[model samples]
Target: MFGVTILGNNSAIPTLDRYPTAQIVTCNDQLLLIDCGEGTQLQIAKYRIKRGKLRYIFISHLHGDHYFGLIGLLNTLNLMGRVDPLSIYAPPELEQIIQIQMECSGTALRYEINFVPLMPGYTGVILEDKDLSVSCFPTQHRISCFGFSVELRKKKRKLIPDQAKAYEVPAAYYGKLQEGADYLRKDGLLVKNDWVTIPPEKGKRYVYCADTIYDVNLLPYLQDADVIYHETTYLHELEGRAAERFHSTSVQAASLAAAAHAKRLLIGHFSSMYTELDPFLEQTRPIFPNTDIAEEGVTFLV
Candidate 1:
């Protein structure tokens, strides 16, 4: 279930059909919300994303389109009587902003909110739990913004059923064998785990380049990622406007993905001026054939 669900893909303003920038990264059973833009909660409901499964939220910057829905989402969770704790990783100033909102409304959340501040120019692994690990890197945005790379670790060894049976190992012990544990026979003979198992396969990776200008420095973080989400706020014709606004054009996003050798590229965060999104793909696919518009409610498997 390693995939990304696009909740809102539009930029700054919320249009009649398009919302803002928000997405859900589904890593197995865990769900991570990336950038709670305006109308995020409604999008979640429309998409039928299990809200209780959401464990973490990552905000790219302090931009209104990126995190304006945080307070609303939190309030909704509290109103629903949710008691599970939630974690948020964002710029340091967001903590104060959220605190002020909570104070003004006198709303005491039922669940614990753990706010992890992402300082300026910070880049490192921020979380590691079970089979999931997430790292953050600085991006070239108007404000201090960051991109996230989520990796799903593969820990279990591949078991050879034929070899295990050759050693007369019981079927009940196969689980232990996959954990790299030696199997002991009834006669006290040990069957080495390596004889029946191979090393685990490499894990899958997903990179989210949240709201940033076209920059080649991001290649290192996006290298060989199974799926990458890069903002394409405008078409190629508006390349100048994109650069002036610290946003990316369709061609720029595809170029970055091609340079990084990413398996798939998901482009979104389209400007409000564009009513139809077909031109984005028409322009980007020529540069990077794997590029796809990050359509709202569509989940792209990583």
Candidate 2:
């Protein structure tokens, strides 16, 4: 169930056919909402996502298109009588913006929100739980922006059944062995945990490069990702315009993914002026054949 569901792929404006930038990453039972643009709640409803499982929100920047619907979503969760605590990771100014909105409207949330502010020029691990690890890096945008790297780690150690049985270990205690606990024998002998158990399986990594200009420095974060989502706001022909607007072109995004050796690339945040999205794929796929369009409501497994 580790996958990313695109809610709104369009950038800036919400056209009749597309909304703005929003996505939901499903990490096992938990859900992470990234970049709550306008109409995100409706899109969530349309997709029938389990809002109750949503535990975290990650905003890339303060642009209206990136976070205009955040306050609304928080309020909706409050009105829905949510009691679970929610954690948010974003720029430092987001706290003030949320506080002002809550104050002006006289709204008190039913659930607790823990906001972790991301400071300028910071690039390091922000979260590490039992089953997940998350880090953030600065992206080249018009304002202070960030890209998130979310990883789902395997928890249980790999057990060697043959070795365990050769040591006369019972199957009843296999679960404890998988939890990395030493086994005590009836004759006062001991079996070390690592002697019969191997390391856990490889983790699944997903990186979201939220709105950035063509920059090679991001390769460190994007390297070897199971899925890398990069914004392709324009075609290669509009390279100059994309640079002026601090956005990326289709070719640039694909080139970065190829250079980083990411397993797959999801390109979105398309400009509203473009009626057709085929050109984006046509230009990007030639460079990176494993690229996807990041279509709305479509989930890509990582």
Candidate 3:
């Protein structure tokens, strides 16, 4: 159930065939929308995503392509009569911008919206819910940009059914046993928690390098990720332009994925000039064989 769905993958401009930048990360039952570029609402509808499941939004930077659709999406949520609280994580200025837009239109949302700012040069854990934890780190971009690392944790203890059955433990109490509770027999014998269950397994992680230049400092943030989405805004031949613009080339993205030892790499945020996406994959696969295009309308499991 934990995966990422690409909505838009183009950078700087929106073309008929490509979009700006947007992604939906499904963390179990909850959905986190990242970088709501223009046409994001239409993309969501085209992909048939369950909008009601969306609970959080994360914007990497203030670039128009990264957050232009935010206000529209928020308005749509209000139009849908949503009452659940929505939390947004973004740079400090985004809150004021959203508020101003709302006020200018004399619009009020039906649901409560909370804003959590990612301060400049800040890095560390920013969110922790019952099943997931999210951390943010600065990326080398034109503006004050940040990347997100999401870890989905399993809290329940692993149940050993055989051990429980051997101890004459009833199935009715299995749920409690998984919660690390001790069992007491009718004869007053105590069944220790460890005798029938083990701690939950380690969680899996998905790291999103929203938009960054070819900077190796990001390796620490992407280390050992289950899946990583890094921007490859240009082909290897355009490395100079990419560096000058504070965007990454295909080779750079793959190199980072290889260095981080990530299970797989999803590259996108392509420049509008490149009508063909094959070059991006061709350049990255040679460096990191697991690299794949972050194709819109597709979901990648972490």
CA lDDT for candidate 1: 0.94
Provide the clash count, candidate 2: 0
TM-score of candidate 3 versus the correct structure, residues matched by position: 0.95
TM per candidate comes to: 0.96, 0.97, 0.95
Tens digits of lDDT, candidate 3, 2-40: 899999999988999888999999999999999999999
Point out where model 2 deviates above 4 Å: none
Q: Report backbone clashes per prediction.
A: 0, 0, 0
Q: Best by TM-score, which number?
A: 2
Local distance difference test values of all predictions, in order: 0.94, 0.94, 0.94
Can you write out model 1's per-residue Cα lDDT over 1-302, one digit (the tens) per residue? 89999999999998999999999999999999999998899888889999999999999999999999989999998998899999999999999999999999998888999999999999999999888999999999999999999999898999999999999999999999988999888999899999999988999999999999999999999999999999999999988999999999999999999999999999999999999999999999998999888999899999
Clashing pairs in 1: none
lDDT score of residue 59 within candidate 3 = 98
- Evaluated at residue 12, the lDDT of candidate 2 is 92
Q: Candidate 3: which stretches are off by over 4 Å?
A: none
